[model samples]
Target chain A: MTALAESRRRPWILRRRTRRIVPVAILAAVFVFPFAVMLFTAFKTPGDVFSTPPALLPREWTLDNFAEAFDQIPFWRYLANTLFVSGMSVLGTIVSCPLVAYATAKVRWRGARPLLGAVLLTMMLPPQVTLIPVFLIWNGLGAVGTYLPLIVPAFLGTPFLIFMIRQFMVSVPDELIEAARIDGASEFRTYAQIVLPIARPAIVTAAVFQFVWSWTDFLNPLIYLGDPDQYTLSIGLYSFFGENDVAWGPLMAACVMFTLPAVAIFLVGQRFFIGGVSAGALK
Target chain B: MRMTTIRRRRALTGLAFAAPFLMGFAIFIAYPIGASAFYSFTDFNLFQSPDWVGLQNYERLAQDSSFWKALANTFVLTATGVPLSIGIGIAGAHLLNLPVRGQPLFRALVYLPTIVPVVVGGYLWRWMLNSQYGFINYFLGLLGITGPGWLVQPEWTKPAIVLMTLWTVGGTMIIYLAALKDVPGELYEAAEIDGAGPFSRFLHITWPTISPVTLFQVIVNVIAWLQIFTQPYLLAQTRLNNASSGPGESMLTYAMYLFQNAFSFLKMGYASAMAWILFLLTLAVTLVILIGSRRWVHDGAR
Candidate 1:
């Protein structure tokens, strides 16, 4: 950083900041490049999209793909279903995870320690291990075509989210909970009135993750939601494969639309989402 | 005694709070795991009751060439893909951590792909890797290098999956970046003053500090690759209800195969058996990583 060191650097490449920026720029650009293609392809004419020598921009930009995507599929219906599922999922996480975190992290009870351990252990299990049996349970109740298989699990509690919230709740000063009780607040009162307010960051992180998971989820919906009318945007967008020829422009446009909500949520809650990478919570 | 009554009341309060998850675990998780184990040993296909077949499904999985291929493909990804992702991710984090303007924005751009809906990511890659008109080949063409048939050739499909996997290595990068930020800068300065080279300085300081996160990422990445479904599943689709597994079944991933046996073939018992094998495989690999990395994964207390 010294002026003398800067002036006499053997090569411009030895200029440390310039050297660093080159690779970083290339890496970032590589990651962002696909997204740029997705956006540009969405606007390109079909001919431009598959141009023999591919070009980044369309010769004549158009909105025809977005229109086609809507016409080709039940775009609005699928979007509505995705939003409802994601929103209800966020609602479910907000209501359930923190309460569970409270009991396991704040309250003094013998079961608390073992329950936390159980949560961690369960978090490590592969989803496939339980995939078939869980589906059977839903199918047995004749809830396969409904949103119950997806939405109801969030209300119960997701082990990962519960574990995350618990890690945050563990650091809550014991004095705070003790003081809330000293004020004659009941256990539920202390949770709802005091601890819940303090747990906003963790709750927001949980909401961001839950909303994205439900919105983007394919496997459960693919298996359980047999009816086209019940399909979320994910399953709906995937229907492009069923057709003989993939409409590249429309597919790209639908991909863009499908990606936006998750990106928006991530942007809005960027801090909490990134901050939830606590070393303890992950392992 | 009043003390015992108060204790009982406190226990009840905690129980009320934890009830939802506990009941959820019992019915949804514990029950399914138990049921799956029982079903793994039987020949139940949901049309009728399970008939005990002892070790038949497990034995059949041994003879199942599809099972071996799926296992091999998954291992290739995990063995090659996970390490490459971790290596590139860590290296990328080091570069991103260099003193530069716009560091935060660069960091976020790297993570952007990780959050893109996986299905969207899959379909976009399918387009992007198209041999003729795909951007990848187009770029390669510009470089005067003929790119291989990325997703089309059976030999190339797994590499395509790995390529896609690397694009999202940013998730691993961010986690390592967080760990990197925790390393005391003074240690690096001290090492530099002692005339240590960059690699040695990194060897002594950075690796030791971030090894825990590395261990964590390794285990997590292994599990993810083992259960990779959506990418291969999406890529292999040619028509509705026509189960294809890419060129020569190259894309028949373990989870996908299990899904086919259970749902498509109506072989619930067979699928359940596959589940248990997957569980043991996961457990064994996880243990190997955990036990193997003990010397390297600093517990921080040291």
Candidate 2:
């Protein structure tokens, strides 16, 4: 086995491994030190934050910044709004993208290839190219300043998610779909029962991505959500930054809160996140 | 006749499956693209209907100093940022591929920054890059070196943005890491038998193996940098009352300027023109990269 071979070769490899530790440590520090600093700063008092020589560890750790962050803004309201938008977006993306992906990847029809090409073309098109006209259209419909502008597009099936899901669906064996068809399954029934179960991983990947994207999306919300009542966490954070530019403690605390859900999602879905990205790029 | 009915039924079913995306594409993508093109040639604001003004918006863009400045600034960022990011990604990937202890933890540490929202990352960097009482300068002082006021100084602003951008290179690094896994250990063993040093072995074996991934990363990063808005927008525009570009417009990227034109100035036509230009530039760059990739990318056949 390769394990036996590797073990025999381990003496030389083991020596080289020790040499690698220094660079690995440096890289880890470079990447992680800021988050550590942010965490420490969030716990620090305002005086401790602005001390002459900045402290890596807080002199007296406190929850005052978190309390202040809440009092300074409608933090809970923005969080609820963000959750609502992101939830709707994830639901829409999962429902719609896979249906379209099935059509393009498995359905036997003359239009399927051209439809796939259109999806790829749309993926390459910049959102800015369509930004003005889309805004105008939404404005004409009186959807501006509402969550409609933000959430409605997800139902339409994003090109990137469509492409990614289609890529996954293409590799699914035709015999399985054929078996379902031979059993007199309806096209929709087959898609829902057989294909959807098989493509669960891809759907989860797409959902996680959509959730993170919607959660962190600033520009669309910035353009559409003019009312404070409709503002998501991203725009809420931006507005908070606008008001308290020098209030680093509360700002850092708010940022930590803003980032926690995304970080938690990433940690939980780390496997799918890495797999989805590599699959997207490599395919 | 029976066979024809079945074929028609299949096509109908396909259309049913595709209907949602098709409807969205027609309304959101197709119509918007056509309308944006039409709007590009018109003088329109949200207040009134558009008046046809052929090529005037493009002509104004040609002469607009701020437009030119945004274009130049974006190019500067893209030109420097893309290569620096690719370099760091490759180096980090190699470091990660080393046989070591606790590799998963190290990988996670490097990748953790990427999952953080840009809004949070931008604000965090703004604080750390603060001229006084910030950690970056303080850390530098420990080594007896003075750090500049990163966000305040015009010359340092773009580089500071680039550095912050590099912090999220973990995404690209992961892609390269995936590519590294695909490289054969036998190739390395053969090279080692031939008395090749580690650097030479990398150049001969590893470089060729990952060139395809490098091409893909380059195009993706180029498009991203071309459309960069949030990092600079958040860093420079702290207050709602002041939306001006920071410190001599150094942080004013093309996308931010386009957003400003559309929203702030209400120059819908002008912004449309800028967007079309950006689209064309993205297409041109992507084409050049694809064409140039023929020389360097090893497509596995050769």
DockQ top scorer: 2
Candidate 2 lDDT tens digits, A1-283: 9976886778776557677798998998999999988889999998899997888899999999999999988999999999999999999999899999998999998789999999999988999999999999999999998899889889989889998999999999999999999999988889999999999999999999999999888888888888888778787776555444467899889998989999999889888988888889998
Docking quality (DockQ) for each candidate: 0.70, 0.71
* Per-residue lDDT of candidate 1, residues A36-119 (tens digit): 999999999988987888999899989999999999999999999999988998898899889889889988888899989888
Once model 2 is optimally superposed onto the true structure by TM-score, how far is the C-alpha of residue B27 displaced, in angstroms? 1.3
TM-score of each: 0.96, 0.96
- When only the first chain is scored, the TM-scores of the models are 0.93, 0.93
- True-contact fraction in model 2 equals 0.77
Q: Which candidate gets the maximum lDDT versus the true structure?
A: 2
lDDT of 1 by residue, B75-176 (tens): 887788888988998899898888788988898898889889888988899889999889998888889999888767899999888888788888888888
Clashes of 1: 0
